[model samples]
Target: MTMIAVCALWGMLFSVLLAEPVQAADLIRALMFQEAQRVLITSGRGLVRQFPDGAEQVMTTPVVVTQLDGGMTLNGARAASDMVKVRGRDDDLIITVAETPVSDQPQDRLSDKVSDAAGSAVPPAELGPPPMGALRGPAPLHTLVLAGAVQVIRRGKSLMVINEVDLEEYVKGVVPSEMSSGWHLEALKAQAVAARTYALYQRMMNAGRDYDVVAGVQDQVYRGRRGVDERVQQAVEATRGVVLMHQNAPVFAAFSSTAAGPTEDAINVWSKDLPYLKGVECPFDANSPYYRWRAELSLQDLENNLRRQGIAVGTIASVTPFSFSRAGRVGRLRILHSEGELILRGTDFRRVVGYTAVRSTQFEVQSVGRTIVLAGRGSGHAVGLCQWGAKELAELGYSFAVILTYYFPGTEFNNTRFGAQAPSSTP
Candidate 1:
């Protein structure tokens, strides 16, 4: 009798474990149009203002605006005549609506417009950091739904209209051409999606700018490889089965290969090229930003460390930062720079043995007579749907969610209440 009950329980558990993921349709409904941190609307052909809070104030005068370092500012004007000053410690702005709208598309399309507007909706606003204490000036607040196209300035006081068609061209021709294809856009989208305030958007944009430079160069190198087709897709698919140890609970997923170059080479050289680096030894001879990274790893090293913790070794997959946190925290590693050698110290491997630490993704490789340090770049186990990589792919023709599906296998794409659903808990 006891044996039969145990067997029955096992069957029930097994069945529960096999439940399906959430369906696509359900995920769609669950997905909502997230609000934006700030917005600029063209109120009419010759008038414009910005709304920082979505649907809050009906209208305002002068315009509320804030300044950010690195050539960014937040505008908070609801009308051409008046503006309100938002006082906050953070430097970014959160705009809800604009006084004038140049296009009929939804607010999400603004990036497209800014990226490609054919002509100035209004002459660009005269952009300069607002004089300090300008926030104390009196401004009016009102409410009105703006309809139709209006011109505006980038940093000028005059209102103007911008060509929507030109904006489309900008998105297709200018913006896409200016940035890296996959990873940079992905980071932009992630920031846009996550932004709750204008300051956040500035942060995202700044990060995107940095990410673009690196990704742009790397993409060229990846495509230069001989005999590789669908290079971006292959890179996206490369991260899998590799474990990224972090201070937080481990985040697991495969990363796209296109984003794997930096970290993979770093680890390869550290593990295979020269003897393990002790404190702060410059590992690579290559003259580039990546030349500074000092850590290396392999399946054997990872497995050995896991064994010490009584953890079983999972399948060996691509190692990339996508397996780690969204922000890519490698445990608690800190980057140290001095005396021509880079040093990385943190709780990244305090619990593990035989793993020397370094900061850059470059590594040394020495396997099967290949005495080259496969200096890995980037941080995390490369795998499924790098958010930044996905953006570039999306611009190239992949859908936002499809990019997610392509990177994460065995995971279905859906638009249901859960975007992707888990099997029902109840029998």
Candidate 2:
């Protein structure tokens, strides 16, 4: 065969080999999995249409919804049937399911309303819980699917992902207790997003597999700490309006409960060197995977050395309750910070090639006051996935193939994307 033909064949063969499933045991050790949340259903129209019962109603447009419960009855508003429905054009929908009887909650809707001298009506922030008459009856399980969505109000600028079962519980139960102080909403939202994204990614990658190695790659990347990313944000929003059932009520929750510990005071992020960043430029996004890798490595080294000293030092786990930040001198490497806590600090150049000992004459930690702090360095957890490093490698004009290989090290990205099917297990 000609040189070009041989090369093409070699590439094809290599791609196929990479796609083969690794040993289940090995895969399990390397993979991480989480529950699916904030799922974005592309074919949801059909799924909604499949619900049996005329209970589903399209209150709005293509943004289909369904009532999970019935109307309140303070002055006698009867409970309505719980239903689910997809939005359709004004008259084209031809629903075939029989309508379910309404399980209206008896509510005195008018009892709370009183007209002032000016005849202006107002709503109270603490109307207290809906009157007993209002909650006279509970709606069907399915109907809640929609009612829950409508009840969610806009807080500040963003809408809460009310549909998430876990977060709903946090909002209802945890928030009242001030689990993390007045910043519950902001902190929980961040966690929920991170959790939802991590969950969805796991589901997508492990649809039918024994494990999700990519997640494991990430876990290793963070040295087993909570790692948040853009994907988490996407999942949190996409699954909005879905009610999370925690002990039978809605609430908010964080990405990792452990990550949201006692409310902390502010933190300060400081520079190690006077001209700390001697050669490296500061990074923009601290949550990016790049810094995460640096963190993993530093912690790993810490753990190993600690073990040698016969100390029971645990691995540096991510996702602890902490805000985010960044650091580094102008010419040195940059790093990510959390709540003034240096989660990752860049090492002097000589360290990258496995050299140890402080080359720098000075090293210190700085805090930038935040509720939760993250301090440490290198950039990301020094692990299997160094995304920025990969990018730099990519910029070296390396092929995507080489980039993934270097970052992932031992693993390979499947050239043939797998179908969304559950993989059969070898029990």
- Candidate that would win on lDDT: 1
Q: Model 1 over residues 370-418: C-alpha lDDT tens digits?
A: 1122344422222222333444454455443334433332333111222
The parts of candidate 2 lying over 4 Å away from their true place are 1-201, 204-376, 380-384, 416-427
Q: Please write out the lDDT profile of model 2 over residues 55-171, one tens digit for every residue.
A: 453232233222222222111233232222232222222211112211121111101111122222111112322110122234222111211111111223211112212332212
Runs in model 1 deviating more than 4 A are: 1-60, 65-257, 261-362, 365-374, 378-383, 386-403, 415-427
Task: State every prediction's TM-score relative to the real structure.
Answer: 0.24, 0.24
lDDT of 1: 0.26
Clashes of 2: 108
